[model samples]
Target: MKLKTTLFLLFSILGFSQQNNPASTDSIKKTNIFKLGEVIVTNHQNQETTNRVTSKTMESQNKMEVSRALNLLPGINLTASGSRNESMVTIRGFDLRQVPVYMDGIPVYVPYDGYVDLARFTTFDLAAITVSKGFSSIIYGPNSLGGAINLVSRKPTKKFEFDGSLGLIDTDGQRSNLNIGTNLGKFYVQGGLSYLDRKYYQMSKDFVPMKNEDGKERDNLYRTDQKVSIKIGWTPNKNSEYALGYINQKGEKGNPVYAGSDTQNSLLARPRYWQWPNWDKESIYFISNTHLNDKNNFKTRLYYDKFKNLLISYDDANYTSITKPYAFQSFYDDYTYGANLEYESRFIPKNTLKFAVQFKEDVHRENNAGEPVRRFDDQTITIGLEDIYKVTAKFTVIPGVSYNSRENKQAQDYNSTTKAISDYPNAGKSEALNAQIGLFYQFTELQKLGASVSQKTRFATIKDRYSYRMGTAIPNPDLKPETALNYELNYNVQFFGKLNFQTAIFYSSLTNVILSISNVEPGKSQMQNFGEAEYKGIEAQLSYTPIQKLIITANYTYLERKNITNPAVHFTDVPNTKVIGTVEYAPLEALKLIANTEFNSSRYSTSYGISVPDYTLLNGFVSTKVLKYVSIDAGINNISDRNYSLVEGYPEEGRNFFVTVRFFNSN
Candidate 1:
């Protein structure tokens, strides 16, 4: 299969390249940062880049989740999950929770369920994003079965620097970010603050009302978020450094519910009743690194994180009625503390050996209305080792192994007025062994081929074990860990010296898949390991420098997910196809124009086959440096005014505009 895919991709890209004029390789840098597509691989870590969104593009565009920064990459899709402010990032047909998120190589996903709300991660100080998918290194911890995303923050390189920006958008939304930093030779300090205010926004004119609800969407649907970040660093020598960093964010956003009856082909069944009153997060981390010598290196990291959220609702279907006042005001809190250490041995000429050890503990507690708190603790330990062996000048092989031990501790608050608690010790303990093998062969200076096979496993979350799914699905505490065996083949080529073409074909067989299924009768659900499943996909990216001043890039993904046991007629929560294209033109050195479009096919939210309407968004932005230290940006999103929603009944903003002004100085 890999050989067929390689040959097909080679012939296809080579034939396509013959249609374009020859240009310089330097002009083929990625469009988002360096230019559109250049392939660069790291020999030390065995990491490679297929695409990246440069800081320059991020600086000019409207900032949101880190997911938004990589939307153009193939097989990467963003879906509206629980609420408008909550988004789920799906990679290669995998659920959002199956993928792990990282910041500067530190895990940030809530330890209880390994879920991270991308909306809360505003792009305030981000420098770059790296996506490492299947066949990833063994050191990235557990629960990264599908993929991992790393958000890298920027560090000031100059002696003194200051940057600030303010943006205004439609629907009374406004935002501002301020940053200041300095590199004082021995000790350095940096910090940034961000504020965003969002009020009710409008939908497309073509939208059709459902469940007799007004076509005008909802009222008081607004959001406000703020962030603060600080970092301090000390450099005692050229090859060693120690740093500490802190981040805090708080916000509240209304959640829209599905109206009327989605089970009966009704797009809008339920009405919007509950809204997230407050969502807050805080993080502090310390990083230390030193090079013992040229052949060996050592690094360590420590981090602590806290997350809090509030959900509440009251009143009835109409404004004049009050049926369930003070119905519920729930508070959820989670705390995590973790430490990791890594050692790299390069004693051999062409072999790089890496060993990693990590420990993490998560304490999660929640209060119902005004009741006592129910707490759960999750503990984990992982040890991993890998070696990248360079067999020849053009051939490389990587083999790795990891062992993970996870234990869950549970305690529940009494239902009565008494404030006593009952504790259950060691509710679940799961241990797994995973391994992987990968090979990269440089067929030629302009062409490369890579293939890998991996075995991965993920443990169940606390909620997935004990809590009922909002009175619908019953949770079973004895659920087993989900596991998968993945295979992938990759081909990359540079054509005409100005075009970068890359393609990958991947397949996975997943077992012990946790899902909600029929309990015994109708209208009831139970969480269970339903059956085995298969997933396969093809992703391709083509970047061309048609001219020195004009660049074009396009990416597409085709995915198929099948339930081997059930043989269902529809695929739930997964889009079959995703596509993105971009055009960046610089008519003048100081003036530039950019445009991109994203497309997603229909997606089903349930086994019953109700789906969210497909959508195509057209966006464009123009930026100009009008002054030596000042720049201006303006853009329009969803320019086509297409009435659509990523999640059923939760309409997205339509035809919105934003403008920003930035002031920065590095000297």
Candidate 2:
């Protein structure tokens, strides 16, 4: 017998006994304490949820990447058991690609595939990372079916401010970052630069690779990167502001050597001779806002991005075999243009309304042997509106709707050697209409309840409808947009002002699901609208402080996924249950310690008869202020060294250590 959930629904009923009077003093102190599954956006206070909207000591976390930091949230998983290129953040059994990333209100994703590499984004210049799960705000543009994630950058208000850090890892790696900003009365300037050099990380002692691929440690897994960015802003008055920004980034990484077993061996070829030669990006943008009064306000953003990636495939294992050792190069380029404009009004009492329009276009080019093989464009236009109505002092309602239009233009696929076009070309147009409604009620000073029902639609990506998927899948320009009808319910309870518990349950019905299955030929798949899916899950988080300087938190999620079109089969990448626990303790005024534990249930890949068993991991961190301007941070990841694989053949790195020395000004 197998257990589907850790704890049954009884925990929901038991929470009622813990509700108590609200604590005003402790509430202010809790403002900087980042709680699990808590919304941290700085938007207007709404009746849907209540908590601190800002953090004063966000820099204390010493986060290198956003993926690991976000893993602490309920229902958010950084599962390593999949392809490294896949989005690391999974929400309620939905792929992260379905969750869009917004930077200062601009959506950012790979125009060709709709994937965002969360690990490549550093947290050095972030003000906060805001996440909105099911029934998210309508202001976020299209392709946000599962939810939305926003990386809010910082704004400088001082004459001069600078923050920098340098870190060293036991795995022969180094990381350095610098951020500086200044305010010149009416004008402001800010800039940041970061660099990372890392080598192959060691695995746990318990992990042992196959005979031929075995080494003292993981092989051919190293990365080097550099990034630079600048932003200039003008603030004429308290109610108006304008800004311009530019960013350039470059990266080179080696794919891990693929170890194979007798049962399966797809990884045996590419991992041995191919590597990413270049991954580069350039972006320039402008943003402006005007706040005339509560009755009228406006904001707009315009941006252009250029992305280039290259993969080099070698003809020989030694890479330098004396006999005409040549290599082949494949290139992908995307030139993207996007703009967004929004208007808000409050002409009626007890009501707030918002309207927005957005435009986006991606011109893509694929080249092999220094010759163009494919050229296409993806474009979209959207209009949306939402209103918040206060029906009573303790009750509120929100309703929203959006219309989207998308088209693919000038798509052509031709052979590099013969210059002959493929018989089947991809070009099409599509449209979708989405709507949602939400309710929030404050039952008491210490408790609240919220629920929402929404229908969301996500458009197809360029690769989703065009790419061959390396011979495993064929192109299909007729693929339709995927849609999901989501239902959500949540409850919040507070105890003695120092403890809090939040629980949520959600169900989603997905239709016209686009999937790649064996339709083109035996053992091969084609992109098509082939299946229907349903997902339901329950999640809960607890935050409590037993003492003045210590805090402990825990969260868990139980999920069920049904392939409505085929109930006997299960999805390949999701786990059945997950639990996370953490402790933060400060024994001295200048010292702080943090520890965390993560557990995931086994996963089954039905098509391949592969099962990755359950596993648990532990990590620890310690930080101390050594001087007025300096702090030291040291930590060890995978302290328990339980050898495991999130994605089969791609084992998790073993115990590793890192130390950082940070510097900043008092102002």
Candidate 3:
């Protein structure tokens, strides 16, 4: 009787298991177009696309052109005089200088003048780019009140590969890049080179007014850029890996007209002729990084840079010539050195702890052809600790704090007047402390919620602290640091493995905000902790993949920046609305087509003054593989040739055409 009972129980259990999972007993296999439910370690708790700003994954096409990927992020804008290497990025409500840029854990902003040129590095080597929303993470140190951009480069891989690409745009621009890498025994070596050249391009629009005597408004542009780099890595044992990298880059750019504008002969009014000046920049960088075990790592970087630029103005009234040249050559040299060390500990199974310390020193000097040279030096140190505790399967909390101290030094010498002045009076030291807290909860398998609160600060830059001008509009050597308090909330949900959506709301209260205000013509502006500000906004992103061959992505932002204390004065640096949409289709196994659209609301040309017209841009591309080892991509930009300007004097490119070919070793 006991044997019979055991057999009966076994058979009942088998029948129930099969009933609950019928597919498990079948021989058929199933495939899915959506994998929204799958996530990895690097994926954060804030799943809402609108609640956070992020960089896309590094891939074959984007590796050589990192900015291309950055162009797709929400609420981000780029200002380019002409060259891709001469562009500036602005995000949220801050300028590029306000948002600190870092590479492999080292600050990339030049120390001599504390200015960063985004075009110095090749995007092909990057593994990822992460933007921390409004000082959300203090691990990068002080001076990041607006936010921070961290670029992580590719590490040594086990495979050996070679990749190359060539491209042409419009009638004048051309680009070529190559990458090669291999792993040998316990060491790895990688190298890359890139070259770019472009001639002047004509505007697609008819900017010539019938009554105007001035020449037609052309795109007036010229640019040349080149870069070479090498990296070596060693992994003697399984517990550690070390990498050494070196890179050199140089470029020259020129703009003949008001960069890009329909205005007539505006260049003639300047002291130098309107034949705008040409600019040249060069830089070299070296870095060393180490990965120790799984919980500790460190990185050190050293960089040097030199820049030369000329300014010119045209005055036809002088008649000696259509353009009079008042030449001014400014020379700048800078040295930067920094290090970062990170430690992670998991003493408790359910809790994780992270701590980091960073230090940096910057020395820079500026000189002219006939006059004096000024020098500025600064040093900073920052440290922070963050703890994450998983209270339960449904709840998690994280809290962090950071501190920083900075010191500045200056010196100057005059040659034309045979005089010397101790500008050291403008040098001083400052300190700041910040904190943040965040919480996340999963309500259901397909729904999640999160919130974060943070306080951040930024110090005055070298240009704002010691740059000398004509009069009492003097640089405030005693300027205090800027600070802000920010709050954010986010929500996310997925539907039937077909639609993925996310939304977020954010608000911020800022104090000691810096403003460049002047009372004179050509306004002499200085950095001042002028007043308070309030920012509130909504962000949303929706992505749908209904089938294996089609994907659609769209994002929108409705943000308002205002001065609550002085509502009469508006902060016009950011647009009130922004939208981006993209559709990609895979027609066959090797053919693809993509369409994109970008739109932004009206923006201010001046501080609460002149307003720029709103505009929309359209672009599309088609790609195909002709051979197993080669592919071609063709695209069109500004399909309607819409005329627009991001900066008052700089006109954006119009209706441009481009073609690119890529080759790789199939083996």
lDDT of each: 0.73, 0.72, 0.61
Better of 1 and 3 by lDDT: 1
For all predictions, the C-alpha RMSD in Å is 9.9, 9.7, 13.0
Report the error of model 3 at residue 192, Å: 1.3
Measured against the true structure, the TM-scores of the candidates, in listed sequence, are 0.89, 0.89, 0.82
lDDT of 1 by residue, 509-615 (tens): 99998876775446777767777889999999888998999988889988989988787645576688888888999899778899988898988866767787677
Cα lDDT of model 3 by residue, 1-667, tens digit: 5325533543333332211222210011011100111111124542334422322222322323444455566646554433222555665666666677765545666554445556545565454555666635666677777677666554434245445567776777777766666667578777777777667654547343222113233433566667776777776766445666666666665444443233333332332223323344444455543555465544444444445444333343231343223444556666666665656667667776767777777777776555566777788888888777788988888888988878875545343455564555645678888898888888988888888888888887776766655343556667778788888887788898889888778887888876665663354666577878877787788989989899888988777788755676666545788898989888897788888888978776555555567889898888787754457778888889887766554456678888877554411
Q: Quote model 1's TM-score.
A: 0.89
Number of the top lDDT candidate:
1
| Candidate 2 to native Cα RMSD, angstroms | 9.7
- Tens-place lDDT per residue, model 2, 1-667, is 0111211221222233323332221122232121211222213222222211122223444556666656667777675423343326678877766888766666767888888777667666665566777788777778888887766666665566555667787758887777677778779887888877778888778776574357456766777778898888888877777889888888877666555452565555444456676888888988887887858878778899998988776665555432333356779888889988878788989887888899999888887665656787878989999888888888888898999889887677776468776544545579999899989887887787888998998888888887876557777888888999999998888899889888889999999988777757877788788789999999888988989999988888888888898765667667889898889999997798988889999876444557677889888989887865557889888888888776666677788888887655423
Global lDDT of model 1: 0.73
- lDDT value for candidate 3? 0.61
Clashing pairs in 2: 81-646, 81-647, 203-654
Better of 2 and 3 by TM-score: 2
